[model samples]
Target: MNGSMTDTKPDTKPHSPVLIGLAVMLVAFNLRPAITSVGPLLTGIVAETGLSATGAAALTTLPVLCLGLGGALGPAAIRRLGVDAGILAGIAAVLVGLLLRGFGGLPALFAGAAVAGLGIGLAGVLLPALVKRDFSRQAGRATGLYTMALCVGAGAGTGLTVPFEHALGQGWAAALALWSLPALVAVFAWAPFAKARPAAAASVARRPAPSLWREPLAWQVAGFMGLQSSLAYIQFGWLPAVLQGRGLDALDAGYLAAVAAIAQAPGALLLPTAAARARDQRGWIVGGLAAMVAAFLTLAFGPEILTVPAAIVLGFASGGCFGLGLTVIVLRARDAAGAGALSAMAQGFGYALASLGPFGFGLAHQATGGWGLPALLFSAIAVAGAICGLGAGRAQQVGQAARGP
Candidate 1:
């Protein structure tokens, strides 16, 4: 077994673990909204500033791309600062980026987004490992809550942005910047992590992270993550635009995107819980991923009438895949460190590579001048996710695949 993931005996002894769990969920809930909230509002910002199509796309693509790079570095950052402190730093980074964007114009918009992505990406990787460390016996349940919270954050970001903008009479920039408030709240809410004495967490650092990148299962997991993520990021980045391509207005496009965004919460809560109860994750992995494929197929082949339900199914199914994928990383590993390593390996490359989905879809739209065929591009990516997820879902320890030199 991977040294880092060695499962400890569950402590049945009572303690109020729910408070800590809630705090962690709150943190999870804030992770994605800032990143996703901007996507639906992209056109408004672009139109006001006269940003090019490439510039508008970069706002979305850059954050996800940086998520990949930041995932690789998160493990090291947590080791240096402790999980709580690392999260605080990440929160602060995102806030700064948010403020930059609020200041208006192109330079701040792109530069701030890249910086904020780095912060979100780091926090994103750190959270799951921390969950395993804190709630060992209930990794599945904890991950379910965490993933659910994440979906809620995503949905809120997509669902609320335009309304928030209009309500405050602040325009999209000011409304977009308001998302940073949650980051600040997250930083304060996690102050307990900073209180962890140095000696208290010394054990976490000494037990070296497992060699996850070298493991075949690790690669398989990362591949599933990236492949499905390519589909997801495309939705976050282009679904509204794709809908608009179908003869919908901008407001109509945003509402359609909202349907997909809101669907994620239930999937995040349900699928991972189911996967955890099973003997092998392969069935859940294959089946849940297939649901994602079906969602895309409905969109591709069906007429406009199918748009609403298709978005909902696609959103829920993808969130389920994410929750299941993350659970597989935690359950298949032996400990917190193993979970951390898996998180890093899977998300780092997964998201970086996944950024191509939106880029390709946008490029295809530009090249082909329509969304009809470009939507098919994502359908193909979903099929690839199924293959990768099935392999990673096997009940094998990531550490069992290799030896130390």
Candidate 2:
């Protein structure tokens, strides 16, 4: 593991950096729409499908669980398919999943979500490695761009689906299906790179790396990633429902969710650069988590007029936490191989842990017949994330101290 952590290799083929960056962003753009699109439409889904709160939660949780499954499988998948081809495969799965989701039934919806989650898992794991491999000199900046695209994509899905539904008069299913078009675009954009088979493919395949399960720093990072992600996914899966419960209409709730997602762009674009320049990331992580907790509480329980403001704050704070989360994965690694290993460990274990948030939230709401218990759950997650961030934010590369003398 230590040996793999330090190995560095150069790419044989010189591609245009601008083009590669564009392709990376385009791929990132497709990662979130499928998931975000569902939240705003959840009410209608439950109405038509006759699903209880628990069942609805399961509908949302399935994809996230698959994300973990996909992430855990990412290393082996990359080894076999190589990075470019792996990402291409992931996007193709997403395209199929999106189309499947539009087929109008619970079976199709769950199946599509599961398949898309797997693709998201695979692509999400590889992207950091790609940035670390190709943009080694400016990884922080590249990460920001990647994260920004994710926010924009999420915002588009959250904000646009209802409008699309109303405009086309094709119901929620068709609105959900429209996101597939972007996935299709991503497929073509990423295909050329897969064909080229960049050196990153060979480099990762040649390396024999150990698991990060035993590393303390790795666990801290994963803990923080999981906890924060739980909060983020809860927002993606339930915020609109929560808002609608507060007396807002579906369109208003959807717009609020979109506002939160779009607002993430600035924080996502800026926090990584700032964190990279700082002495240590602990302060940033701690501060972001604190802000996140406050914003969430405000958004959920505060006066109705303050809802938008709270969401904006929540978005910035959450984006900062997320941006810092991905940044630390890169910063705490010695090389691209280490980044990939840490990413898989953090995201795989992390997302698996995160899958519980929405499930628990639903159960809490169902059990209590109110949002109070779920609000408490969200607060607890934020506090736990801050605690983990304290350890993860320390300036130490994972596995360095774990290596034998």
RMSD of every candidate to native, in Å, equals: 4.0, 3.3
TM-scores vs. true structure, each candidate: 0.92, 0.95
Best by TM-score: 2
Q: Tens-digit lDDT track for model 1 on 1-405?
A: 001223222332222456556767777777787677887788788788887777666677888898888787877876787665776677777778877888777787787778888887887787777767776677777788888888888888887888888898978878888888887787777666545433324445556888765688889889988887788788787777767666777777777787888798889888888888887688887777677767776665578788788889988988888888788878767877788888888989898988888878777777777766776787778778888887888767787645421
Each prediction's Cα lDDT score?
Answer: 0.76, 0.85
Model 2 lDDT tens row, 262-342: 888788878887888887799999888888888888877899888989999888877778888888888888777788888
**Can you tell me which runs of candidate 2 are displaced by over 4 Å?**
1-13, 402-405
C-alpha RMSD between model 2 and the true structure: 3.3
